[model samples]
Structure formats: structure tokens, C-alpha cells
Target: MLIGAVVLVLGSLFLVVPFLLGNTGVTGFVIGFIASLIPLTVVLLTVRLIDRWEPEPKRLLWFAFTWGAAVSIAGTLLIQPLFALAAPTSSEEAFTYFMATVQAPIVEEFTKSLGLLVLILAARKYFDGPVDGVVFAFTIAAGFAFTENILYFGREIASSNDPGTDLVRIFILRGVMSPFAHAVFTGTTGLIMGFAARKWHSGYAVLAFFIGLLPAMFLHNRWNSMGQNFLVEYFVVQVPIFLVAAVGIILLRVAEGKLTRQRLLEYARAGWFTPAEVEMLATSRGRRQAIRWASSRGRGRAMKSFIKGATALAFTRQRILSGRDVHVHQHDELELLRKIPTLRAAVLQ
Candidate 1:
């Protein structure tokens, strides 16, 4: 019951960001939706291409987005109101300083990072490694940014009565310059959370938490600072950085995708995969071919199910080998595994 409540709370938080953005205006709403959705869809499809073996649960993905929206909204609302009162900005410079340097960096990063905390607390096992922490953090941060963009765009359209430069500027800033701004910000939190989840050291965990938060806050500050110089500002500063980050991100995913291959290799050395099954998940090329083999032979669904079941087998095997009983429903697990051969036979038919 408590777990269910937590999930519900997290989902509602994420749902609100898009809602807020849409309410901004038709033009801003449309532009913001297009800007964020296209990039995110590509990312998702790319993730599918790579991690074909064990897909993260769809429910968790939804929860991440929802968690970001809700937590961000609540955090900004709670914090910013106080900040505004504290700053007492009567001039543009003061207001700008208060907002860009102070309010935006702190509020956005913290709220966006809350999802990492939730992920750490709830499902530590699913986090494959450090890179996953970064990816998940980026996801929540982007979700928050997407919603924030909606609101900002809606206002731009409402005031100007057109989808103008302000909207484009936002695209450049949120979509371009700081593509990984929020990711970097919340990524720190994720690193800490990931480490903490794996280890049970409260003192070290607290230290990790602060260490992570510092870099995130600093990055947000620098990104916002870059915007202060209006004319000189361009993707020149960001493009190279983003490219480097992109390479790192790709390598991380590629490494993660090789988990099955690693597992297969471990036992392939001992003859678990019959050389054929081992070859299937060994490389990106091999994984694709395996999927295609399954799909072309008109066994797409069964292939997907088989691959998924096989992954479950792997993870269960891990737990069993570790002598863990947390998930020791062996009868149920075997029953599920037994269905795979039946499904495969149907595919063969």
C-alpha cells in the first residue's frame, strides 16, 4: 500500500509539467511539444535499438517522467516564492541575477534530481550501473525542462500573438545550449543514489550526495551565465561540449547493451548458450540480426517474449547464484520460463 501510494504521488508530479506547458498558449504549446518530443522519441527509439534484451519496465519510465513534472512544479513553486521575496528585485539586472543565477539553478536542479532519490529508494536493483544513473537523471531533468518550456512558450505566444524569436531562443537555450544541462545537474544526484543503493554506508552516502549536488549546481550556474552575454552567445560553446557528452552517452549505452553478451560469454565459456544463443546477444550487430531473424521468420512476438524471458532467467540466475531469497519464487519463475519453449514451438509452427 505504501509503495503504491509513492508511485501514485510520483506519477502525478510528472503529469503536471506537460499540463503546465500546454496551458501556456497554442503556439508555445505546439513549439515546445515539437521541440522536446522529437528529440526524446529519437532517444527512446535509439535505446530500443541498443537494449533489445531486457527492456526497463514501461511503468517505471512513465513514473520517471511523472515524478519529474510533479516534483519540479512543487519545488519551484515552494522555493521560488521564497526566493522572490528574499531577493526584492526592483530592477531588471537584479531580477535577472536573482532568477538566472540563483533561483533557476537551485530550484530546477533539485526538483529534477528528486526522481533519482525516488529511483534509489524504490528500485535500486534495476539500475545496471553508473551510466544508468546518469541516463535516468537526464530523463527526469528533460521531462521537467519540457514542461517548463511549455509554460514559457505559451506565455511568449500569448504576449506576442505569434510563435516568434522568444520561442526559438528557448529552443536554442533549452534544446541546444543546455541539452544536458539538467542531466548534468541531476546526474550528480543519481551517481550518489546509485552508489548508496549499492552500498549501505550512511556517512559515505551523505558525503556522496553533497559531492554530487555541488557539481550540478555549479554547472547550472555556468550554463545560465553563458546566456547573460546576449550577442556573443551561440552553440559554439555548447556544441563541442554536447558532442563530447553525446559520445560518452553512446558509449555508456553501448556498454550497457553488452550486459547480455557479457553474461552469455560468462556461461558460453561453460556452454550455456549453445554458441547460437550466445552469438545472438554478443554484439549490436548480432542483437539486431537476432531480432530480425525472429521477426522475419514470423515469430516476432515469441522472439520478443523469449528474449525477455531469457533475460529474466539471467537476472534470476544472478540472484540464485548470489544465494538471495528476496525474489525466490522458484516455482512461479520456472512456470514462466517453461512457457517460453511453448511459445517458441508456436513460432516454429
Candidate 2:
């Protein structure tokens, strides 16, 4: 937590410096910053819905967002300029196109992905599966997009003769139309790392990160390359792809819920949880009903804790069954098992 706090502070410095030094006036900056929040809120609510089955730790989620908004953006700002210093002189238009299509995708996706790598390394236990990966990826990407949108919006507002018109146009294009652009790119990496977390060692998980980058970079490249035909291509190509990805994510979420139930059932057989308790813990409706019951008895908070612990316990059992890092998961399994009864007692009290 201390390390995360320090990183966030340093990243905040990186984030603020550009805005402070930019040509955008205070008014433009403030407007852009406020506008950026609209999309950020939308993206976060969507992530929350997807993560409803088993939420990642709040601290880790915050770290991921900070890493994207601050650290990843900082890295991109620092590194992309070096390419200009090294490149041969070219027409300004040509250079801009090259930077957008080639340089930006590679640098931004890679920097964004570093946050996932950090999570896999530092908080392996929570890095459970593809849904978790998508959640973290979307969060980090949302942060990056929020910062990027501010830059774009502020610059447009500052430079344009018609600030109001341009602001609305840009907001409609970016905030309304393509808010998930960054999330989709980085989510590819997160999804792969999530699969790696299930069965692979840390070394393999790292490799999976690189492997995932291929598709992420590809999609970003294609998106950037579509300059003139963006609207048509967006509707024809990107929309379909987004729909397919959404369907896949839905299936993965369903699978995760089923996996939770399956693992908890093992515990039920061993007398850790009653069959009814497993039913209550595994299903969304069951959980809501349980919480309502507990709330009536003034133990809503305790019920939530019990449900959370049981969910974590189910995943820990999954890690044990997978036969990778057994010792580590064994410790987690025992700890979760020990705490669960207490949580249940609290819920019932």
C-alpha cells in the first residue's frame, strides 16, 4: 500500500505537469477535465457490472487505474518524443500519420499493459481469470483515456475559433462514440494474463502478457490507420468486433459463476458449507436474498463479508485443484476457511 501510494503521487506529478504547461487556459483545462469524467463514469459503471460476480480488491483496482492515468501516460509522454528525435526529417503530415498509426499504438498499449503485469506480480491471488483481467484492463484503460481525452478536449477548445462547437463535436466523437477504445485495446492483454493466472506459473504469466500484446497492438494499429474511412469502418468492422468480444465476455462471466458454484460444492461435500449456503453464496439472487435476510437482523455488513470470504475461498480451492502453486494456495485456503465460520456466525448473530 505504501509503494502504491508513492507511485500514485509520482504519477500525479507526471499527469499534472502536461496540463499545467500546455497552451490550454485554465478555463479550457477545467472544462476538458470535467467533460472527461462523463466517459470515465460510464466505463467504470460498466466494469462494476461485469465485476459483480467477484470483485477485485479496491486497493488493487485503484492502483491499476493510477498506473494507467499516471504511470502509463507518463511513460508514453516520455518515450514517444524520443522517436521524433531519432527519426529522419519528413513532412509534418507524414510524421503525424506515422506517429499516430505506428508509434502511439505500440507505446500506449505496452505502457497500459504494464499495470496488468504489476497486478499479476504483486497481487496474484486476485488476478484470477479473464473477467478479472477485463475489469482491471478496462479500469486502467479508462484512466488513460480520461487523461488523453482531457488533452485532446483542452487543446481543441483552446485552439479552435469555435470552442463550443468543437468541444461538443470532440466530446460526441470521443466521449460518446468511442469511450471504450482504449479499454478494448488493453483488454486483450488482460484477458490473456487472466487465463495464465489460472494454470500457469509467474514466468508463463509474464510470457502470456507479451503474447496478448500482439492482438492489442494490432487492433490499435488498425483503429488508428482508419483515418478517412473511420466512420464507415467503425460501424462495419469495429462494431462487429466489439459485439463479438462482448458476447465472449458474457460467456466468460457465466463460466466464472459456474466455477464458483462448482468449487464451493466441493467444500459443501466436506462439511465446510451447507448445500443451501453454497446455493446462497454462488448465485446473485441467492446472495441478494441472504443479504436482505441478514439486513433484517442487522447483520448486512457481516453478511457481505461472509459472502466475499466464501467467494474467495471458492477461488482458492480452484488454485489448489489446478495444481499450480499449491503451497501458496494452501495457505490461502486455510486462512479463508478459518475466517469463514466467524463471518458466518457474525452474519447469523
Candidate 3:
């Protein structure tokens, strides 16, 4: 409740204030939306696909994105300037470097990450493992990037003598090459939080956050500190980091697959699931087959929902077995249970 209220207030302020100030004209607004929409759509779809086996709630995903685009950006706007005022600088270039390398990494990463941490504190059940963490992290980063793109696109087009060429160039640089940069950084933190959520007690979640956050900040610093050759920085640093993040994501996916099978087996032992259902839940190919079978009877959505809810239920039960949460777990279990019967009947029919 508190988290939702905070996000609602901050997001409204950030979204409305610029418009009231006449900072963004329609042309700049249109350009920004077009510039961000393509990449945002692509990234969102990709992340959703990765999480297809066990989808997080759509509402929470939107909340993460909203928090990032509106709340986090607003908070960064207020906080970074304070650090600039406090620091001594030799030249504009030096100060620019200071803001980019030091202030940005600290402020932006924390701002982007705070949403996930809050969700972890407020609604830990959404996260079954690293994939959930990574998905939320990527969604929030995508939101931040979208809003930042809007502001940058608006400002650049408004200021430039040749808006056409400059806008295209900026779009190519930020939209194409660097779309996933923010996601990868904050995702590092999210991955650790997911691990803490899965394995360790709630008490360790904070320590896990720092462990993830430090790397995110360091990487953000490295990228920001690099000199003016965008291509050089991208190839030398950005690409490598992206590759590492990709490998990490793949590993997490594999881990989720294993965890799913293990959790389903526990359910099987409790007589809640069958071996066939366990196998279907465990493998991507089997899941596709199950979907196809359900679709033949016009119940694909129900089957999908059943699979997703069952996955969440399994993870929640796993967390309970580990001796952690109770009330949230019980609440989530009941909610999932209530919605799943119709789906189960559809699939069975």
C-alpha cells in the first residue's frame, strides 16, 4: 500500500509537471514516443518471452515500469543536482565526467533499483527466482530509458539547428545500441535479490542487494567514464558486459527449469500433480505441446494461466518449505487457487 501510494504520487508529479511547464512541445513529444516505442516494445516482448514459463503479474510489471520511467527519473532529477552542488570541479568537462561516472551510477542505479527492492519487501511472492528479478529489472530499466529518451529527444531536437540529422543520429545511438544498458546494470542487482528471495532468509535480502548493486554501479561508471567514441565504448565495454548479462540470463533460465522440475516433484509427492504434468511443466517443448493441446479445444489461455499460477504456487510453497513467509504465502496461495480451477477444468475438458 505504501509503495503503491509513493509511486502514484511521484509518477503523477513527474508526468504532469513537464507538461504544465511547457517543456515538451507536441513535435518533440511525438518524436520521443516514436523513438522510444520501437525499442521499448522489442525489449518488453523479449523479456516477456523469457518469463513465459512463469509470468509475473501484469500489474506488478507495469508498476515496475511506471516506477522507473516516472518515479525513479523524478527522484534522480532532484538528487543528482545536490551532489553536483556539493562537489568541487575544475572545468565543465571534469564536472560532466563527475556526473556521468560517479553521480549517475550511484543515483540512477539506486533509483532504478529501489522499485525492485520495494517490491521484494512488499511483495516477495512475485519472485520465485532470478528470472522474475531479471524481468522486473529489465522492465524498470526499459521504462527509465523510455522517459530519458523522451527528454533527450525533445531537448536535442529543440536545440539543434539541424533537427533531422541530429535526431536520427541520437536515435540510432541511444535507441539501437544502448537500449539494454540500463536493464543489464540494474538486472545485476535484481538477480541477487532473486537469489536471496529463493535461497536465503529475508534478513539477507539487503546484503544481497548491495552485492548486486555495487556491480551495477561499477559497470555504469565504466561506461560513463569512457571517452567520446561511442562505437569504441560499445565494442570494448558495452558489448562484453551485454554478453556477460546474456550468459547470466541463460544460466538463470536453466536454473529455473531445474527448479520447476524439483518443485513439481514435491507437488507430485503430495498428490497434487502427476508425473506427466510435471514433465510438461519442466520442459519448454512440452509446455508448447500442452498449449497446442489446450488450443485445439479453445482453452489455450486457460491452460497458460493454469501453468503460470501453478508455477507461482510451486515457488511459494517452496519458500514456505524453506521456513520463511507465512501470511503473504497463504494469501497468494489462496488467490492463485481461486483463479486456477476454471483453467484446470478447461485443460482437463
Candidate 4:
């Protein structure tokens, strides 16, 4: 109820803000949408592919995106002006520095990370691990960045000079040069949030949240600060962050693969899964081959659904083993079980 109320208030503000600024135009929207979407597609695909074993629910994923674009952005718009008013600045440079390096990063990263927090609070089941948290983080960042780009483009369009040059420049900066900045920054928060979720009873969720928030803010600060040459910023600052994120994601993927393998073996031993099915489901390659074999017989959809259902069942059972609430998922567990026979019938033909 709280999340819904927040969303309602913020979404309304998000819709109304443009009209107040007189910046609502089709051209700006189009340009921003195209610019933001191209990179977002790549980010989404990369995130999804990384979590090959168990994909998150699409509805929840979309909610995270919407929360970022509407609620987070709305909060930022409302809070930032207050911050500007509160911040003491002797000159324009000081004001700019205050806004960019301090206020913006704190406000924006917290707001963006709030989307993941909402998910954790409202729908903990969707977030099983670090990969799921990263997925939500990237999606939320994408949505936030998309709306920001639109606002920037709109302002550029309203500029007195030729808007085309401004549009291209803004696109190159926001869309190309630093497309993943928000994602990378906020993903640090997501990583820690995932840890908090996994270890919810460890009496350290508060500590984890702050630990994540600090790095996110620091990274955002360094990126916003114009204290270095452009090439130095790119090579010295950006590349290492990107490599660290890449390495972290790869490590998480391997961990998830091992978890899947362990779960499948456990289920096979318990008679819930056949050894053949367990072996096939333990690896990405084997899963793909299973799908291909079913596709060759025109049962691709059924086989795919079956595989997904089996995977969910394994994860669900693991959750039960971990003493998480299982009653809420009773229906889902039964449904997946129901699909297994139909999936087999369709695929075995």
C-alpha cells in the first residue's frame, strides 16, 4: 500500500512536471526514446542472459522500471530544488559543484536504488540472488536515465541556438559515452541488497544497505566531478569500474550455475527429477540442446515451459529448505508440477 501510494503521487507529478516547464513535445520524446532504448535493449539482454537458470517475473521487472522512471525521477525533481535552496554556494561554480558532485549523486542514486528496495520489501520472492538484484538495478537505471534524457533533450530543443547540435552532443554524452554510468553505480547497491535479501536474518541488513549506498554515491561523485581530463576519466575511472562489474557478474553467474547443479542433483536423488533431466538442466548448453530436440519435433514451446517450470520447482524447494515462507507459493508449486506431464507429452512425441 505504501509503495502504491508513493507511485501514485510521484507518477502524477512526473506527468505534470513537463507541462509546467512547457517542454512537452513529440520531437524531444522521440529522440530521447530512441537514444535511451537502443542501449537499454543491450543492457536488458545482457542482464537476462546472465541469469540463464531462472529468469525473474516480467511483471515485477516492469514494475521496477516504472518505479524508477516515475517515482524515483519524480522524487529527484522535487527534492533537488530543495537541496539547491539549502546548499550554501558563493558562486555559480560552487553551486554547480554542489549540485553535481554531492546533491545529484546522493539524491539520484538513493532514489534509483529505492526501486530495488521497494521490490525487496513488497516482493521478496522475485529477488533470489545477486543476478536478480542486478537485473532490477539495471532496469530501474535504464528507466531513470531514459526519462532524464528526455528532459535534457527537451531543454536542448527549447534552446535559442540550433537544437540539432545540442541534441547530438547530449546524445553522445548521455547515450554513448556514459550509457552505463547509472547502471554501474546503482548496481553496487543492488549487489549489496541481494546480499541483504539472501541473509535477511543475519542482523546486518542495515549495515549492508549503507555499505552499498556509500560506494554508489562515491562512484557517482567521481564521475560527476570534472577534476580530470576526459581521456583520464574514461581510461582511469570508467574502464576499471566496468571491468570490476564484468568480473563480478561473471563470478555470480558461475555461482548460480553451481547452485543450479547442486539443486538439480538434490532433486534427482529425491525422485522429483530424472537423472537425464537433471543432467540436461544443470548446464546452459544442455538446456539449449533439450529445447532444440523438442523444437525439432514441433514442441518447442511446451518444452521451454517445462524446462522453466522445472527450474522454478527446484528453486522453490530450495527456498522451502531455507525456511522461507512456502505457503504463498503453494499454488505456483502445484502449477509447475501440473505442467511437467503435459510438457513431457508434448516433447516426447
Give me the candidate number with maximum lDDT: 2
Residue pairs in collision within model 1: 13-69, 13-70, 14-66, 14-70, 21-150, 21-151, 24-154, 25-154
Selected candidate, larger TM-score, 2 vs 3: 2
Q: In model 1, what lDDT does residue 303 have?
A: 66
Weakest ten-residue segment in model 3 by summed lDDT = 15-24
**Clashes in candidate 3: how many?**
0
Residue 65 in model 3: lDDT:
89
Per-residue lDDT of model 3, residues 1-95, tens digit only: 75665657576666545852355477777777777897788789879888886788888887888888888887887788898995658888778
Model 2 scores a TM of: 0.90
Which candidate wins on TM-score? 2
CA lDDT, every model vs. true structure: 0.62, 0.86, 0.80, 0.76
- Give lDDT tens digits, candidate 4, residues 200-302: 5434444666678899999999888856496788888788988899999889877776677787788678677788887677677788898898888888887
Query: Could you give candidate 1's per-residue lDDT for residues 177-203 as a string of tens digits?
Result: 555556656766765565554443445
Lowest summed lDDT window (length 10), candidate 1: 317-326
TM-score of each: 0.78, 0.90, 0.89, 0.89
lDDT of 2: 0.86
**Tens-digit lDDT track of model 2 for 1-349:** 5575576659666665565447577777888889999999999999998986468889888888878888888888778988777554678888888788888988999999988998888788788688889999999999999888888888888899999999999999999988988999999999999988887688978898999899999999988888788899999998887888889888987787788899999999999999999999998789999999999988988898898899888888887888867899999899998999899889776
Model 4 scores worst on lDDT over the 10 consecutive residues at 199-208
TM-score of 3: 0.89
Give the C-alpha miss distance for residue 21 in model 2, angstroms: 4.0
lDDT of candidate 1 vs native?
0.62
Steric overlap count per candidate: 8, 0, 0, 0
